[model samples]
Target chain A: MPEKSKSSPQAIGYLYGRRTRIFSLLGLGIILILIIGIATSIGSVPIPLGTTAGILVDKLPFVEITPTWQDATATIVLDIRLPRIILAGLVGAALAVAGATYQGLFRNPLADPYLIGVAQGASLGAVIGFLLPAAWNLSGMGVIPVFAFIGAIAATVVVYFLSRVGKTLPVTTLILAGVALSALLGSIVSYLVISSGSKLHSIVFWMMGSFSGSAWSEVFLVLPYIAVGIAVIVIFARLLNVMQLDEEQAQQLGVNVEKFKIILLAAATLITAASVAFVGTIGFVGIIIPHAVRLIWGADHRFLLPLSILTGAIFMILTDLVSRTVLAPTEIPIGVITAICGAPFFLYLLRRRKRAIF
Target chain B: MIELEMRNVTLGYDHHPVMEDVTFKASPGEVVGLIGPNGSGKSTIIRALSHLIRRKSGVITVGGRDIEKIKRQELACLLGVVPQLPLLPSTFTAFEIVLMGRNPHLGLFEAESRRDFEITRQAMARTGTGKLANRHVNELSGGEIQCLLIARVLVQETQAILLDEPTANLDIGRQEDILDLIKNLCRENNLTVLAAIHDLNLAAQYCDRLILINDKHIHAQGTPAEVITNANISRVYGAENCVFTHPVNGLPTVLLSALKKKEIGRNTISQR
Candidate 1:
């Protein structure tokens, strides 16, 4: 039997205390709003912080603030900066939550949204769409994201089936299968990218990832997919918690393991595909944001999902701001910024913690 | 109260058959011990009963309803299972793991209520796991994890419980405490329990009936005194001289002795 620690029960009560969770969630909410406002104010044409708030309030339904800011400032805040920030936030939230879900599903802390080749598949699809005849272009920004979503889902389905031996999904086998497939698909994408003569610059830029050309149209296009996917995941958060146990134990506890796995995989993949399709592939946000949240709060998905959503959004908005302003006129790829900032912090977390969290 | 019955259940993995034409019945308020050699499909039988795996043929029913026909949530309410080696997430606290037993009773969007917390706390208290509620499952010892699993099943509040070698990692005193607690719950709540146990003495002491499996079939089954005999033990387990009746209860008991050189050599040759 385990040795009884007199302090453990009290420690547990504190760790899972309801009030602490509520307060932390509330704090994150405030931080997200602050980051959005601050990020909106930091672009090339620096809009005053108060004017950024005023412009946002003016757009609200009933509340109309007198236009104190110039039309150019308003355009910068509302049209260009606001859409980019919101898209970045949405994609970040989507990737982080998807990452958390994948980590839980695979029972591996290293599992990320891109672990199963979603990014590579989406990249291939987007490249194909770009290489298609110009006559097929229906809108200014068209076909790429739709095709990307399809390719991501198709790749995930293929990986899932290939990894299954009978009814069991061994984690090691799944990761290996995903890695192998990702390498294959990535080569195909590289081959396609090389053959595209004049479109090399655009395709490479897309692959490197950025929120540069983000528009309200792109946001509207991805909204429904991300919204529905997140809603489904949030609804099944507790089931995800139960799924932390082995498949057999979860099944015995009345979770329809196979069905639940399918539903969660689909939802997570949908959001991830949508997030990556427009912004290319932002790496690290999905993996790091969730881990950062787990470090602060506990691993309860009920809290983890929502907290990850907020933290990811905040992190992405700040990273995007850094990408744009750090080197003026020439913007660094958002992926590079995320990697540079995230990798060192992740290493620090690894060095600081002694026990395995997962 | 629920009565569990399996009729000619054939269980296996893939196409390879392990246990064939197995049949058993345990009425409400009875504890049935499934005792067998390792690899004899004791855990497979429990898995089949829990619907973790499908039986190749025949029907397994609880309270006269086919387990296959029942919905997952409904079946979970009817029977709770304690797997021999459960893989739990290292980060989850014992309280959170125990609280998951309320999953079947909850709807898709429902959160645990105060009553659910009360029941889970009561289960932890009953299993003497209240002190360890804050600890991570990965940090816990094997015996503590076993007790935590039992607490989880108790919170499940099923009419029947199935345990797969539930006391394998526990000390002698802890083993008795857990078995006695299960036995008391069986008698008081009219719960049917089917446990796969390796320890024959504990089986004879706690189980109302015992099923001895040998060579993929039920070799002998009855009250402990009837099923555990010198001839049966010698044939099924190859322990001829070790089988003896208990002094106080008159039930069969196994006493181990150092094997003679010839006997050890013969057993080693046969194993090879």
Candidate 2:
């Protein structure tokens, strides 16, 4: 008897050009836009959706819309809310993509962006920057973000060196080294926090992660690094999929296992460090957003990477919106909002699926 | 088709040699089965052969060129492997997993083309896994995943194939089906094939030749009749196993001897 693929047309859809996958991505793109609009419209002054659309449309080069809104509202929308939202989206995207990358690289579903001590190192760097002389601020760039980036890179380098036995960097060794370093750096950060006299409040707030004073300059600063990192990762998406298998299998299929792991680990860490530099140490987004995206779309990293970006952005924007509005003039740390909101929703997804998210 | 040759190869982990000076060759259009005991380095041999492990003391070559001199991408195009019990991401559909076989053929920046998809579809169909295309890998049984792995290697289009415990997780009937598929493909395509199979009988039946590994080396190598003798089986496996002639094919078949079945009276041993 001849063996033929007589599976239904839907099965062919899975094997071939993924039409539905593309359409769904386009749909998510629209959802991202709507979320951006909503995030911008519903601030303290409460700009209407129509006015928000008009103000946004006027900014487009080819198209001009009459600015019926007041200059105050325009300033509030573009300068304040827009940049803040954009920064949140960027941080969210960076963490989510990095988280997904780490999860794939480690071949463990529990792996998160912060698994390798990026958050602890960045936080320690920020605290040291705070404790140092104010003259360390360079070129109007805040000392904390720069120091945080350096700290993150330094911490990862140490971990990498510590874990490497030879040419190969085993994933388990890297993870163990990271956990050990995180504990050390975390203690130093806490000790510094207790000793700091006046800057205690600011340091604690930064540790909790906030988008309170985001500016267009900060958004533009991190955007290039985050974009480049995510692009490099997406380019390796196919190889990353192969890496879901064990190292031996991956190498048998022609991937240079050690080199590929290093490249991805570097890319993920770079984005993660950049995100943490400006955003303090936001947690949960790195772990939860990937799960959320995997819950809806399958775990193909090609889609998973890009969709995680969009889903992460929308989720953070919404979470930040709640962080500001729920307290009504009193600001809460974005990290707190994420934990409160993300945990239950993540639990809901886990319970509903009742199986592996990876 | 490519020739896979291992000359005095010694493989190990962390400077500890697991297998020493192992030499074997699998020619095109031939299936060579590696038979050994539980810890006799069967998997280690496959790993070294595929260049997945560094050989401490000797050379392994593909098509007359040293594998160490070959670039990873080129090597991948020449050899494909089906490893034992590889973990697949739970959410990846079977088609997507099979589609990954095209990675070596694709450029770094290139996405999977339509032709790649067609090849994957055909491979899955041939492996009798077409219905599994839309199903997630997590939902599949171990046997089904093993079959899917075979399909992946088929789409890989390598001149040489290495299989590590290919039938370890399969049922009885599927075992024959997989071996038959491998044998037919090897002959049809004139591909060099090497499989590490635990079942001495199946290995003896399907393989053109058998290499018995013991004490971290090739203990015996020849035609199945020569390699699967009762003396060799007992020596390598440390068991008084019997090798019977297959009535239909006139090949050697191994049957493990029972450990002298004695009727156990419930109270026979020192009952008060």
Candidate 3:
């Protein structure tokens, strides 16, 4: 067959073309890799950028490089900084994708991973874990994340049941119920904090979120949840787009709205719980990164969801890097860094484009 | 080709019955217009037929199969709908909205392929909405949005179509154009169509048959001449004589007169 004419619309993949979408996914993947390598080298000792790349490439299969770096530098790159960098990226990707899922599922631009009380519940669980007697704290058990995970799931289930009117899971009711549960859980956490004696400072620091002493175990623990959650979320991307037309139209378009919503909610909540369980609640990423991706790459969730994964991972790593280095040993919270950097940058992007992002 | 039938269906919210034991059927290649007063279950019936809501007491079948037994995805391939007050995301482009009609055909892992794009573009062209493809949904006028909704439904390529007040926001010209397009498509494709139209005259002109709803029941069902008579209009709408034959086509037409003091019957006047 003859090549299609370029003047007509069919010559490309409708709007935004396949080129832009592919370029976005691939380009951001490369940037994320670069950011990870650079971030691993930037902390405390400040290793050289080339040495960081060499160290990273050396770890790949069958690649052997002559050791030019000191033993301490390798320890910093391989053992300490690499794990933290990987953890930050995984958490970031999880939170961002989860946020995008909530926004699409609720059809509200302001929605985030924490919108459904996942943060409050996780915090409560972490606080309880923090206050528990030392006898219960076993080595390598990682009690806090487990407690946080259970708390998050429990809170979501309560909210889901509360929001149902007959058989339908109304979005408005879901949001309202989430808000109500969040307030209740937040108050309980605060009470637990006040009643506790020596654990208060550690509790507050953990709640603020950080990758200060992240371990490879933490990364491994979080990988399965985030990976599965994101895979499920991407599969529902097209359905999420149709849902923007409201549930009534979605049903008419052939979606089982009730079943679909539950699946999405479960996936979003899972990744969010995984992310919050380890690093605390990183606020700005889930809410803003998706919007940023949408403003530049249209609102098709197929591209929007995947692009957010890359954008979010890079953003989280960079924010974690700044949090540790900008304060230099004092260690500003990662949550603080994310809000400070994300809001202004998102606003700048919004101002540059006159079109509506949501 | 499909035949849509609602057999003794009761539709409404919980503990409420908007319409009771309603029975109707539209055959293949038929345009069935549902005319009703406000709150008389037009939209409710449309929802029931499309499987958006379950019928309380009866069966709704499409193409001789129970709709309740059909999977939602398969039902979508068989039926398309143009909602009255559709909520289109403002950030989405018209082309993207239209392309969503192909959702039923796409698999979980699949993206929009070349053929889906071609069909969507053709649907937009057919509905005269090709010019608005790149424009955001919020930027378009209501009539334009309605036409885009039509284009979206057209992309479904279903064997049956449902429309709830499909021309409510449109001007007279666009109203006639959309109805004519719907009628032509119904006949040409041998597809079953059911539309809830508020305009009695427009419904008469375009619909192959009419089902007039009054007081939560299908009060009249027949051809335009049989159902659109002066007596039927006065009894169902509780209005004075307003039905007349169209000069051009001799189909039924309605021209309303302002309520005048003399037009009120002496009994209602005395009671007032």
Best by DockQ: 2
lDDT of 3 by residue, A208-269 (tens): 89987888888898999999999999998889989998998989898999999999999999
Question: What are the per-candidate TM-scores when only chain A is compared?
Answer: 0.92, 0.96, 0.95
Q: Candidate 1 — which residues are off by over 4 angstroms? A: A1-16, A161-174, B259-262, B265-272
In the predicted model 1, the residue pairs found to clash are: none
Better of 1 and 3 by DockQ: 1
Model 2 ranges off by over 4 Å? A5-17, B239-241, B258-272
For model 2, residues A96-176, the per-residue Cα lDDT tens digits are 999999999998888898888888889888999999998777887789999999999889989999999879899999999
Kindly report the fnat of each predicted structure, to 2 decimals: 0.60, 0.69, 0.60
lDDT of 1: 0.88
lDDT (C-alpha) at residue A62 in model 1: 94
Superior by TM-score: candidate 1 or candidate 3: 3
CA shift of B268, model 2, Å:
12
lDDT of each: 0.88, 0.88, 0.89
Report how far off residue A217 is in candidate 1 (Å): 1.1
